[model samples]
Target: MEIHKKFAHSILLLFVVLATSQYSCQAQNSPQDYVDAHNAARAQVQVGPIAWDDNVAAFAQSYANQRIGDCNLVHSGNKQYGENIAWGTDLTGQAAVDMWVSEKPNYDYSSNSCVGGSQCLHYTQVVWRNSVRLGCASVQCSNGSWFVTCNYDPPGNYIDQRPY
Candidate 1:
């Protein structure tokens, strides 16, 4: 029984090692690979194996240099998402210009009527269209290729944000 248990533990450890190595190899993209991914995204292509831009110092430097005058780049870290690259420093603000990658138009406008400046029931209006590349919003990271969705508006109404 003791020998059997030891053998099982060794197999498990080997499997773990193999799995970790494979994942790391796949996740580590070369600097050129990062540039290619960024270019594809600039051309409105959503390629997979998204580069999350975690500890890629070289990639970050190259991306910043490449998009110098094209975007207002910002490096930000999220506790849950780890280190990430963002565009338009205040891209979360109301006046921020973002890219809407959805296929249709999406609208969100809401107002609450005030009587004598008193608080009233809150009312909200949310509208959207159903189509490919319509109602979705996306923002490219400073890393160049990765995109995060900003579903607040459609593609046409907001500023044309791009990676270039």
Candidate 2:
């Protein structure tokens, strides 16, 4: 009976080991090691916390000894969805200018009310599309992305202290 119990325990351990092999199939590491590595990677601030100016500076430096202008470029983080890449930094705040240059329209505005204010939490009325309707964004941080709830003002340009 003792020998039989030992044999069953050994088989169980072997199965556990084999079941975890997929996580470390790329390299010859154990499942515990992979979990540790994953935890370490999660300790960093997600994408949105990155400074755009720093990124611009580094990118510029790579080309020349140039400095990224400190025009308060969007302090957004990197990610799969939200990345406030300055589509165009033109002096003239023309709506059409941005629309023309952007391949992705610079942003994807959500449909919301503007009477009084907007339901958007963190959007800025950057420019006027028509009159009251303006561009806004709600900044957020996610996995390697700076997500801002972007949108325009058609229902009335501005966010009132109300939920829509």
For model 2, the run of ten residues with the poorest summed lDDT:
43-52
TM-score of each: 0.25, 0.18
Q: Over the stretch 63-143, how does candidate 1's per-residue lDDT look in tens digits?
A: 445445445444322222212233443243111112322211222222213245542111100111210121112233454
User: Whole-model lDDT for model 2 versus the true structure?
Assistant: 0.28
All-Cα superposition RMSD per candidate: 14.7, 18.7
Q: Which number leads on lDDT?
A: 1
lDDT measured at residue 32 in model 2 versus the true structure, 0 to 100? 34
Query: Which candidate number would show the highest TM-score if scored against the true structure?
Result: 1
lDDT of 2 by residue, 1-164 (tens): 99999999999999988876532332322223322322222222121111113333333223221113332335333221221222222211222223222322222345333334422222212222221222222211222222222222222124432211
Clashes of each: 8, 16
